[model samples]
Structures are given as structure tokens and as C-alpha cells.
Target: MRQHGLEAAISRRRFLALAGALGGAAALGGCGGDGGASSSKVTYWVPPNAELSRMQAYLADVKTGFQKAHSGTTLDNVVVPWEDALTKYTAAFSGGNPPDVTYQIIPWMNKWRSTGVLADFRTLDKGFTDTFLNGVNPDYVKAAEGPKGELLGLPYVGGYWVLALNEALWEKAGKPTLPKTYDDLIPFAQAMTFDKNGRKLGESGYDARNVETYGMCWAPSPPIQENYLWHYFWSFGSDYISADGMDVGFKDDAGRAALRHMKAMVDSGAVTPPNLYSDDVRWQAAVMSGKAAMAWSEGFTAEYAKQYPQLRIKVLEPPAGPGGQYIVGACGFLSVAAKARNRSGALDLVKYLVDDKPLQDFNKLILAKPVRQQPSNYYDGLDDPRMTTFMNEAAALSKYVKITRILPYQPQEYLVGKINDFLLGRQSMDAMIDEASKQIKQMAKAAK
Candidate 1:
């Protein structure tokens, strides 16, 4: 809930990716339109990542933008601070004051759908969806469907995982670069790492026990572990759970590869040892201090720009593994409450918000990738070579990316629990997989 700025959300949200949750927005139904993103009177609520003073400006822009495009409409916008989002959204829903439209993260989306309070956008404007999500895959939209099979809304936000490299250290190490495939990550990290005595890991005098500058950085803290490792699990081909949600399906080569890769990073002295920084905050600090040459995580785009204004942060999609170049994340939406006061307007607005142009302002403010699935440069209007790479690589790699989701179990605890044991050396990847499989089975049985 970055109401004013980054310091709050950055420090408080352990994962930053999923820390702030959104839910509870809808309007009592009555109004009409051609199931488009238009309405004469539109009331909308969005997460307050925008600056407070600029709320009116944002609203004005939306009002102007919508009216200019549609030819006779007014937008009334509201910014709900992330911290107070849940409270306010809840009041809106339970107190019968849900807005005409509102956006939320995936978890709450399940909640909204189960309540049967959200409009089925698919049914509302079938033609618009085709136009809005022209190039996007149908699976992403299907995944966002409500618990009861209702197409709640189109998923509108996503936070992609990208690698942040230290240019100076990379050039110093003869510019060890991104791998053609993820399989080469360890070797690259090895080449980029340095022992405390200024010896590269493979050098004759290199000492693993006395490592100084590492090529990679990560923390085993639960949330951070889940955030950083989940994608690897996907890349390495671990489903984390069975399709039916009744099993943890990590008992295979893919699962082993995922854990082994993380271990190799640490063992090769390319990543900061768990002994040094036990949390991402500290691990990120290590990166800033030149203790690590690179880190792969979220908030890097915005945080680097803010915290290390002068440092040019190089970003690339994490290399493709055997399972390919998919990223792990959730996609939520800006749904029209079933009973929205201006259903047509809500539909139209949702359509607009998910497009490239309408998302420009929101995208400018947040570092995460936008939800629009079409090919759009990640940093199109921004100036910077690193951002240029960010755009090019993201555009080139998006097809390889997948946003995974499930409702039957809590992925954070379910997967992170086993990963923690594996990270701590208390269990083998196989052992962890076995344990997770058992736990998921039990949980599924209980859920039944």
C-alpha cells in the first residue's frame, strides 16, 4: 500500500510481490451500456499506489480520457490506500456501498467470486474481451474465472520476476553474461564470483570459505524464498501441486533441479551464503554494497531507480530452464460488481485500464509488469539502456512466461515450508518433495 512512497511498502511487505492484498469493490446493479468501457457516471476504485496529492489529477485524467474516447461520460475515481484497502473494500461490500468497479489481487478474487457478487465480464461483453485480449492466451483468462465457473473479470495486473545485474562487477569479471539457457546459470555465477582474496572462484588461489563478492544474491526467508524459488520450480518443471490440487507433485527430476540450482548458487560462492544475510532486505543491501554482483527479484526496477538513482540496473528475463522461461505470479482483475451502478461504464473502464495506453500512468508508477498480454515494450517511453534491455527481453521472453495459480491450497506455506527445509540442509530435495506431497495430501483430504 504505497500511499505516499516506497519506504513503507518496501519495508513492510516481505515479498512485496504479494504483501498488499486487494478485495471488496462493487456497485449495486442498474445502469446499462453496450457492455463497453463506458458510462455517463463511472465510479471506480483502485489501489492507492498513486501519490495522495495526485489522486484528483489521476481521477481527472481518467474522466477526461474516458469522456474523450466515449463522447459523453464522467468518471468518479477513488484511491484506496493499500493498508486500508481491505477494511474499506469490506465496508463497501458488506455495507452496500461497493463502487461501480474496483481491482484486486488474485486471492481476494476467489473470495469475491465465491460470494457471487462479481459480474461475469465474459457474458457481459464477449466481443470486447476478444478485442481487449487479442494476443493474450485464453488460459490466463480461464484461470481468472470465479470459483463457481463464472468468468469474474479479466486479470489486469501482474508482477514479473527479472534479473538485476551489476554492470561494473559484470565488466570487471570480463562481462559474464546471461545464459542462453538457465542450465548455464551456475557456471556464469562462478565466473562472476570472487573470493575474499580477490580470486575468482575457479582461480588456483580461490577459497570458498572466504568468499567476498558473489555473483548472485538471495535470502531464504520464507516469503522471499517462495517468491524467488517458485519460478525456478516452474522452470525446472515442478508443478508444486497436482492438477486436481490433491497432491504435491515435486517428486521428479524437475523438482530436484530446482533445489540443486539454488544450492549450486550458494555452494559455488556465487550467491551470498545464508550465514551472511538471512533476509532479502539484508541480501539486497549486500548487493548495493558490492558484496553480490546480481540479484533476481521484484521491486528492482522501481527500487533501484529510487534507492540507487545513479546505478543503472540491468534487467533480463531469468534464463529458460528445461520447463522453459515461465515466470511465477498471479493475475487479478478490475471487476465490475454484478450490481454495479453503471455496468457498461465499468466494462468500458476495465477494458481501457488493461490496455497499453491507459496503463501508462499506472505502469509508470509501479515497477512490476502490466497485465496487458499484447507485445508492449516494458520500458517503452523510459530512457536508459538497461530499461531498453528490459523492454526487449520482456517482449522476446513473454511467450515463454506463465502465471500459475490455485485455490485449493495456500502456496506460500505449502511450497515454502518444504523449500525452507531443503535450503537449511535438513532434507534432500527428494525428501522435501516427499514431505510436501504428504502434507498436501492431508490438507486436501481435510479440505474435502
Candidate 2:
């Protein structure tokens, strides 16, 4: 959490005093329409990403609509970077002050709750919690719940790693078919690999890589594979943790097979060598510039493509693996600091932000699939065939992705990068896994 210099001005005592004096706040079961974000003025902190910028643009309409329907409320927004979110959030709480409501990645919900930074959302109105999607993957829900099964966050987005195609490039490469299974991808990639000079697919093209373009790129660099690789790991029916989270899963045959497959991709030169800092921006540049042909990317790619008018892109299910189809992530939500300046107002803000309408609107702008399947007015213009295809795939195929509890100890991106290096022969799998397992056991012991 990164804090702004201004946060220091609001002391904890002053903040609690402010909340206590806000007399209109209601008890737990009652809705506080005029007190929450519905208050005359309320603040919201969101990630300062392109996704949020797009939302920021439409916030006026959203504020106006809500204010019009109610009376005097206004929605005030703050933008925070993903890397600095934790520090900022902590600073806010230390002073008994924080935004009325704010979003955090799912994994951190439990972490925050343990520190008593989050409110017990179960105390909210009965049907409020009931409105989320049914049959949501249990593992995904478990990730958001704190100790003793307290639900700390509500998933508004169901993020999954997916295959994206540059149709023009694919057709130029001879309209190769989509891969149905992990093994099938090897040949599909072979067909897609081409060079203006007609050299070996990945390496033979040119020192400058005169190949028409790369077939694909897997990010999270050399010594640590990215979390995205988990989808493939799971496709082999392997997990990073045992069911009880008591032991590492890497020594299992299935886990080794998955690692071997990823290693093979690196060895075969089918993917980009890892770049420690090549985040989504680097990924966008590679695909948008036609330097790379395909990617297993986040759903936001479609949303990003809207900025490039000439680029025609399409989304598809990630190729199935030995275990059938697989996906590796779910959505995340917000948690208010328990010691906020306007505690009641903060809870109200949470309810307001997650109200069906805002979530639907946010999902629409980001081209996200809903965690809840119930339809909303937000989907009105999304009936186009292309949109339908992607949406349907998201609904039926994506699965919740989870990993060993050592997540906090092992920077997720670093872990994936390390694994990639091991597979590339830069390091041995046993040696790498041994190091990772050491970290995992330490975390597991601490968790105990």
C-alpha cells in the first residue's frame, strides 16, 4: 500500500471521531442509501490502470444517474497503482482513515482481514450477499474468504488466461486451425511459424528475426515463470499444492510433465525468452505491432484492441490439455478498512460500488465476464456474434485458478519466471523446485 503525502494529515482519532458523529448511519441489516456512496459525497479508490481510466470517463454519467435516482450523493474517485496499493491502504488505516471503499486483489482480502482491516461483510443485508453468481468455483470463493469462512470480497470479474489470435496474421500464415489440446499446440505453432527468408521456425529466421512474426509469446521472464503458466500446469491435472496445502506438488509425475511441456516450449523457441519487466504494455506492443502472432492473454486484450482501430483480433478458449480445458484465475473485489474515518459510510460505499448496476457497468467497459450469470442492462449492446462467441467461451470453460499457499513468500511472477529458466536448461528442475519448496515449506509452517 502506497500512501499519498496528504494521508498523514488525517490522524486515527480524528477519523474515528468523524465516523461517530455522522448520526444518520443505520444498524447492520438496514440499507443506508443516503449514507454510503449514496451520501452527498463519498470517495472510491481504484487501480489507476487503463481499465479504470475508461471507467473514470463514464463516472459522471454513473454519478448523475445514481444521484438523480436518489438525491444529493456524489461519487468521488481516487486512482492508485497496482504496485503501491497495499502501502496506501495501510497508511489510510493506520490513521483510522481510508477511502469510503476500495478494491484489492483477492489474495490480499484474507491478509487484510487477519489484521482486522476489513469489515465482516456477512453482516450486510441478507439478500445482498445472495445476489452473486451461483455455482462459482469453490476454490475461487475459498480464496476470497478469510479464516472461519468469512466472505471478505465479492468477485465481479472472472479473469482467465485465454488464447488471442491476430486473424489477419493467422490467415496470412495460411489460416491454421486452433489447437484443441496442449499437444496439438506444438504443430499449430509450427504451422504459424514463418519467416520472410523461410528459415527454421523460431530461431532460424534471422539475427534480427526476419520471420514474418512470432507464433506466440509467454511472459514472466527467465528465472520465474508467470502465474499464467498455471493453466497449462493444471491442464496436465497437476497443482502447485497438495489438497491439504501440506506439501509441494512439483514432485508428482503430473506436475513434472507440465513443467516438461513448458520447458519444451522454451527449448523449441516457440515463445519469447522471458523479460523481467515486460508487463502488459510490452505484451500489447508485441501483439499490436504484429511482431508476435498469438498470445495466451487476459480478457482485457479485447478491451485494449478497441484503441487500435486497424488491428483485428479475436479471442478463443485456451487450448485444452490432457486434463481437458482449463483456465487459471478468477475476479477480485473491494474491502473497507475497519478503522475508517466514516466506518458506516465506508460500508455503505462498499454496498454502493458493488450494487448490481455498477458491477454490470464496470464489466461492460472492460469486456469482462461476470462472476454472477444473471443478466443486466449492461449487456445490451454485447449481442454481436463476435462478442457472443467470446462471452460464451468465458461462461462455459474458464475455471478458478489457485496455487500453493506459499504465494506471499514467492513473488508469483518471479516463481513462474524461475520455472521457465529451469525448463530452458538455464537451471535444473530439481534444483529450482527444491529452492521453491524450501520457500513454500517456510510459508506453510508460518501459516500453521
Candidate 3:
């Protein structure tokens, strides 16, 4: 899932509302159609994609392939808008009419699991579990597991957030070397930043207010803040919360250092102001339109190139820090509902969807990497060299990346909002840290 897309659809308010409904939903029973092993039908629910027509065509192909593979079986495909998905799923479960299988992100796992509607794939089919485990990445498998290590979901697609540079801008700046460390990035960005009069940053008569091109851009708003910003924290050796999930983890030296470095970038006047371009589209536009020379992006260079053919974009390795090189990744999963009427048929459909052909096709459609092992057609099918480079870099960096966890509370809004306030000079660094820490602790306590 794209960082902005996921964040926009599931706001803090909506998540809290879903959390409230999950409590009562736990006591509700299933009410959908009953289809035993001999049943001829299985219902599936998927979130809508930005490429609606293409996704519809892909789904149609999937239906044909699935029905052909399983004679006498029918696939009931349904598209659910992400904005209303949580409520719809909750209602479906409460009314006992939930789909047999549905698409889910890592964050929603705990909430739906709490509602007692997700099936434990481990118990449903050991053969399928063993096959899936042997074929898919272990990290994705781990992300799909429940607290007790049960297979609550089957991960299929994944992506990472990395640094993307405007090659033309770098070429114009005398082809300065790419930054390998966090400390190196500021100067690298400043070299590319210029004023309306062509005065480079740090040069005489340069004006920050009249910046014609920014050195870098990053999203610090809700929905994508946690997704994109936390890499800096991880690189600085800080986490938002303790591993046990009981206390604040960012109220430390590393966390403070990370915040200071972020502020320094803003203070350098080489970064696009957070208020000016707060969302993903605007963030990409900053780079595409030559307003910014580089950006923290989720491997969207290929798509950006299509829109602006003249601009040369290059995917770069994530910057390293005292903590080491690190990036954040997220995966999408296909999960079966516990109350599925055709439990056996549902399992079959899940396994079928993960098979090589369908899985690779789905990943290609979304421009995501398949969760399965590589050396397959998926990699060979990538037409863009930049996309291939991105895939290769992502695979090499997978060892340093961590899949986002299933947290008890949504922590993006509180943490990112305070950081933005500090960057914008509305609050002191100390105040931002203290206030954010307090809110996080309260959220954890309340979740219990």
C-alpha cells in the first residue's frame, strides 16, 4: 500500500471509532452463507485501488483463472472502498454476514482479530501453511502471525520507503556524490538548493524566502508521518515505544538527536516547508517539477517518470546513521474470516490467490514486490530499469528493514504532530518531546 493512500483512508478518528465497535463485535456470531466442502461458491472482498479500470480487469482475469482451476466453483468478488472498509467489516461481522476472505493491512490485524472474526489459518489447513511458509519471506510470515504465532493472515505484496533523487538536479550541481550518512545529507541537499536569482544556498545574497528549488522534501502530516518519518528514528537507534509496548521509547538521547537532525534540515532552508506540500502527491510534485532535488519516497520513481519523461529520477539507498542503515516496509495480506460458511472453499481460494501466476500479476499491478522468493517472472517482467534497480535495492535492504508492527494504538498523529510543531517553530524541542511522550504513554495505558 502507498503511504499516503493508507494513511488518508484510515484516520486516527476512524481507527478509534473502529476500536470502540470491536468490543461489542467480539460477542457477536457469524451470519453468512454456509458452503461446505461440496459448496460451489466463495465470497472475497478487496480494497479499491487508484487504478480502478486496471484492477477490475485484473480481478476479472483472476476470477477466470480461479474458476478454471477449481471446476464447479464460483468466485464472488467485491470491491470495498478503504474509507468505509473498517466499518463495513465490523458491521458484516456483527451481522454474521462477513466475506469468506478479505484484504488487510498489517495495522488492522489486531483490531479484526480482537473482534473474533479472523480465522487461524494454522488450524484451518496445515498443508497450506507449510507450503506458504516454504515459498514466502519469513519476515512477512512473521508479520502475519497473531500474538500466539497463529497464521491470521497470508502476506502477498510488500514495499519500502527510500531516498529518491532527481538525477538532472544532481548533474546540474556538478554531480556531487550521493550521501551515505545522515550527517552528509544536509550539505548534499544544500548544494542543489538555489534562489530565484540562481544564487545557491550558502552563497552571498542567497535568499531562503525566494528559494526557486528546494534540496529535499518529506511528508510530516497525518496518515504518512509514521510510515515515512520513523525511518529517521530507527536510524538514530530510537523507537516510538518499548518492545513490550508499555512505555515511551523516544524520550532518549537517540530520539532527541533524530529530532535535532530533522530540525537542522528545516533550519538549513533547503527542505520544502512541511506546510507547503504535506501529502504524497505534493511531495512527489516537489521533485518532479524541480521544486525539490530529492525526496523521501516509496519507490514511485517509475510512476513519476511516466508523468514527466524529461526528468531523470534515481533511487538511492536510505541514509545511514549512528544506529545504522534502516528503512520501514509494509505488507498486504489475504485473511479468511472465522465465520466463513465455506471454510474449506475459503482456504482453497486463499491458496489459489497466492499461487505464482496470480500473486505475481497482483504485485505487478500495484508495482509492489512479491512476498515469495525471487528469480521468478515477477522480477523479469519489470520493464523499467529504475524499477528493477528499486527492486534489487529493496531486496538487499530487506535485512535492514523492519515490517511495521501491529500496535495497540495508532501513534502517527500524536508523534508526528508534535514533531511538525517543533519544526515549524511553534513549540520548543523539549516541549515537543515531553508532550508527545505523555500522550503516547496515555494511549498505551488506555489500550489496556
Q: Return the TM-score for each candidate structure.
A: 0.83, 0.75, 0.86
Better of 1 and 3 by lDDT: 3
Summarize candidate 1's per-residue lDDT along 58-154 as a digit string, tens digits.
6677778887887776777776656666676666766555777887665566557678667887788888866766665454567668766677867
lDDT of 2: 0.56
lDDT of 3: 0.71
Model 2 misplaced stretches (Cα beyond 4 Å):
1-43, 49-54, 72-77, 80-84, 133-137, 198-210, 220-227, 243-247, 273-280, 299-308, 336-352, 374-408, 443-448
User: By TM-score, how accurate is candidate 2?
Assistant: 0.75
Local accuracy of candidate 2 as per-residue lDDT tens digits, 1-448: 1011111111112223333443333122112122232335556676532334365575666566655755555566665554455676666655455666667665455457566666656755446665553555665566667776777666545555457677777787778778777777776666566666745474433433455566776655321124356666678887766656655676788888988887776655556655523554565456556666677644434534465556756666667777656555545566654544445555566666567777666666655555544433335556354454445555444453432242333334445655756866777989888887776677667866
Per-residue lDDT of 213 in model 3: 85
Summing lDDT over every window of 10 consecutive residues in candidate 1, give the lowest-scoring window. 1-10
lDDT of 3 by residue, 1-448 (tens): 2232233222333334334444332222333444233357788877654355566688889899889988987888876655566777778877777788888876677677656678888899887788777856676788778777788888767666567788888887888889999999999999999889988999999988888888988656555556556778888998766677766677789988988998898887788876776455665467777888987655544556577767666777788989987767667788888878778778889988888788877776666655654652345446576566555555455555565545777776666778899888999988877787778788888988
Higher-TM-score candidate of 1 and 3: 3
